[model samples]
Target: GNLPIKKVLIANNGMAATKSILSMRQWAYMELGDENAIKFVAMATAEDLKANAEFVRLADTFVEVPAGKNLNNYANVDVITRVAQEQGVDAVWPGWGHASENPKLPNTLKEMGIKFIGPPGPVMSVLGDKIAANILAQTAGVSSIPWSGSYGGPDDGPLQAELNDEGTIPDDIFEKATCRSVEEAVEAAKNIGYDNGIMIKASEGGGGKGIRFVDNEEDLKNAYIQVQNEVIGSPIFLMQLCKNARHIEVQIVGDEHGNAVALNGRDCSTQRRFQKIFEEGPPVIVPPETFQKMERAAQRLTQSIGYVGAGTVEYLFNADTGNYFFLELNPRLQVEHPVTEGVTGTNLPSTQLQVAMGIPLYNIPTIRKLYGKEDIYGTDPIDFLVDEYVPIDCHVIAARITAENPDEG
Candidate 1:
């Protein structure tokens, strides 16, 4: 049931685009050979074309997209999808940015009969919403931090009506619904306890944007207002923050045939603000048993959701007490995925494309070798593939560099 993918559209720019194009070529050459190699189509803006970007030069062909708007050219779903159809692209690979996590892009591509090299639109929507993801994690038997609000409550229920009518939560419904008012947040915070502090989070927030911390009830109102204003109309929720924790994530890939495997993990603890600046693989700080538990939890969650393609399951690990809580699931290839790739020796971008082409996990070359079984019949592949500990080949670390304008600050 393999889908024929002769050409792919790289729907991103800069490093993401370059890496994706190279991975596609390398995978095609190494696996398929010269004549059957996949061709890549890269997009460029007028500015990019003027500068002769590396990805444009690397691709087999290029398409020019409109420039100078609020959203980047690659982020425009209509333009990207239209270009894909016109170019006869068999698949679209959104490499971790632009429209990578936007369900609209994939939904549009699906409607157009072009393959999306990521999870389906509905799956992306579920994982993109923090509340829904948390609920999914808990349902998959993954551990999560305690929080208030009825997870997955109806949008048009009494809670929504109350928020629409008065812009506040009734005291009676404070414990069972998301906080629409400062008073309700404060109440939820008190119930959840403020020992480690409370995090006011926007369910739709990402990249460290719509979050605020309050150590006491006195600062709760201002923090709540700040987050609400920052991400307007996003549902806000309260959770007990885990103090002195390390950010650890498991690299996982699932396929359409209900098979998944954990490709070890990375420790992304070092950060500036909430953004990770340094990342390393095989989080040695945590006990091996703890790491295995995390891998198992991640596999269970991935299988439970029927996730297809590469994704990261992040967790906050308290090394002091050996406890961890599910933070969130990033439903796309992460920027720091190379660290896991280094230790695990897997090309994730290529794997994503293969999964999109209806390739099962057991049929994937790297996964098949790692599973180390001649025949996978009569075994639950999820458990059979990941139950044995696969030692990381080596340790690797990555540091992100950024340049900021001093004058702007």
Candidate 2:
């Protein structure tokens, strides 16, 4: 029954790794009695340490790991476990992206008696797979985005490019059938009333990489093949496109005992090419009642799967219909989490560590309270010393995404 976490290893790299390091540092300085009580360790490649020397400076210990050739292969379970075991770290937190949602990593770490700071492996396995997560959302009374169909390729040949069967999809949800072959794609497009338009998406894709919008028959054929080309060895599906839709999401945190709480909502409609560029908390576009509905649905889905730690539930909201559908659930810390934390006045890193260490959600941090009855500025504008929860009354936004220009190529 050892609950004191003296050391934590951040088994991640890049910006997420940097942010986690800073958050832990701030947490230690503000909450923990001793700033150096929680020894920090960052597992990075040689190049990573050289480029991000600041991480090396912030962390108490820096361990070298293989960066591999790409992001997916950068972080490995063996490397993380070896470092944790050698350095005597009590927990390992996978910063966002890369192997953050890998079920095997958590499963292996837990088996080794190391605390993996995130949801359980079984829960992650369910959420990581889009098809399983959608079905789970439906069962939890949360309306999921309508899709043409769902397909799982043969187990023996995972990358077999043969057309597969259309799984059981709800009548209201299913719009078109999947087109594994070029011929089937053409036939299915005509059958689904292609006048409006159809969207081709990879079942396992994220960050708007494998989504293609096709408005005509010719584009459908081209997009079908193009999508297959973009992402091979993955099942693809088609869905009807909702024009002028708003992208919104709800942030939720849960504990081991199945208690989940939703931290308001965020509107991330300002996106380019399906990638969000700007996000704000307490969505201004969604009505209050609808926002409450989204929060409830998100909590229902989170608790339904017995999810723990910090996660995000995304949705597609249509201002016309006043209806929203579950998009996906990110079962790890998200990039836009800071906006939620800013408004809620909660230290996410501290809460996440507490939850990972089996501390109840209610006991981790005190709810924020108003400093005075007047609405004016002063040295200390607000107070978080209250024992009960207080309503959130401000807006926080997150923006800026620096990237190289593809057109330059």
Candidate 3:
């Protein structure tokens, strides 16, 4: 175990990597006067160099790689290791995309004796598997959607199917099953009650990659096989598609020592076709107690898995009934983590580095400030513990989307 990380590599590209670089710069400025205290190296692709010229200049050093090479690729592993060894980088941080959730990269890095600034590979594997994530959530006492389905692993079985469309089932969210074949799935969809419609999801897909929606039995029959064809390497299952559910998630930080905390929550309800369009923290509408319950559940889930780093536990909230179900657990830095940072005044990126260096959860200064000492709760400014019952005194929102030029097409 390293005591404190010195040189670190920003092993990913895009805005997430840029944000991490900026966050690290800010943290270095405020905490450590020495600009070289924690050196940062970036893996720059041709596109990154073109798009993020500013970051290229800001990095302590960078190794140029080919364009379109994903961070999770094995080839990148050798590249990263060579650069790390050459530059004396003690750890690697995969911001939020590409290799962030890919367990293989972390496992490989660990074998090379380099710290991966996120959760362990086994933890990622469990959370990466949709069905395993569901079972973990339930074991952690979190309420998850009523689901049924099994992962057939490498060997495709009766339950196995493919997925299509733009939506993905976060490899960890299991599916419900009443039948096996397309005819059986259609019949089962009818028996399951499609008042809210039926949802077809891949057992091991995410990012809206393997999902299909059908409003009636006829639609279900027609789309069943086609939906399964969309996904590869996993089984698809059915579920009661929630028509009007608010997507809320709790931001969690955990350390190697088994302690964890829920910073706050975000409402990413403003989404289009399963992609989040906007997100805001301390959602304006949710009551206080309900929010507390979510925080508790999120902490419980992360701690249960010995999660180390910044991760998010998503939920489906029904405003009418005030009920929520655990949706999925994203075991890496989320794109919307800044929303939680804005509300909680937490330096998540820096904290993530500290955790990777073996810092315990409670010992983190921000955690102690937010969750005060046991003896002193409110009056102590230094040890001020954030009251779970009271929401943070700030609100933050984010909006970023991609669009095409119609005229060009």
lDDT of each: 0.81, 0.72, 0.72
Q: Number of the top candidate by lDDT?
A: 1
For every model shown, what is its TM-score relative to the native structure? 0.90, 0.82, 0.84
Best of the two (2, 3) by TM-score: 3
Model 1: per-residue Cα lDDT over 1-409, one tens digit each: 3898889999999899998888778878887787248888988999888988999999989988888761758888988999999999999999886888899988899999999999888788778877667766776778877676432234422222122133223335543547889988987787778888889999888778889988898898899999999899988898888899999999999889887789889999999878889999989998998888998899888887778989999999999999999989888999998897788778889889889999777667766555555653323343544357356668999999865567776
**For model 1, what is the error of residue 405's alpha carbon versus the real structure, in angstroms, after optimal superposition?**
2.3
How well is each residue in 1-409 modelled by candidate 2, as lDDT tens digits?
1367778998776667677778776777776656786888877677876676666677887887765553423456676778888988889888787778878888888888889889988888768766556666766777754454422223211111111132233333322334567777666556555555778777667777677889888888888788887878656676666567898999888887666777776888998766779999978889887887888888878777788999999998999999887778999988888898887777677778878878666545432222122322222322121222346689999996657596875
Instruction: Give the per-residue Cα lDDT of candidate 2 at 156.
Output: 17
Model 3 agreement with the true structure over 1-409: per-residue lDDT tens digits: 3467888888776677678888877777776775567878887777766776666777888888766657433236666667666777789888876667777778888887888899988888668866667667776777755444422224412232222132222332334443357876765665557777777777666667778888887777767677667766566667666557899988888878777778888999998867899999987667788978888888878876778888999998988888888778998888888898888788889889878988666666666666645632233333112344234788899997667466775
Pick by TM-score: which candidate is best?
Answer: 1
* Whole-model lDDT, model 2: 0.72
Pairs in steric clash, model 2:
none
Would you list the rank order by TM-score, best first? 1, 3, 2
Per-residue error (Å), model 3, residue 11: 1.0
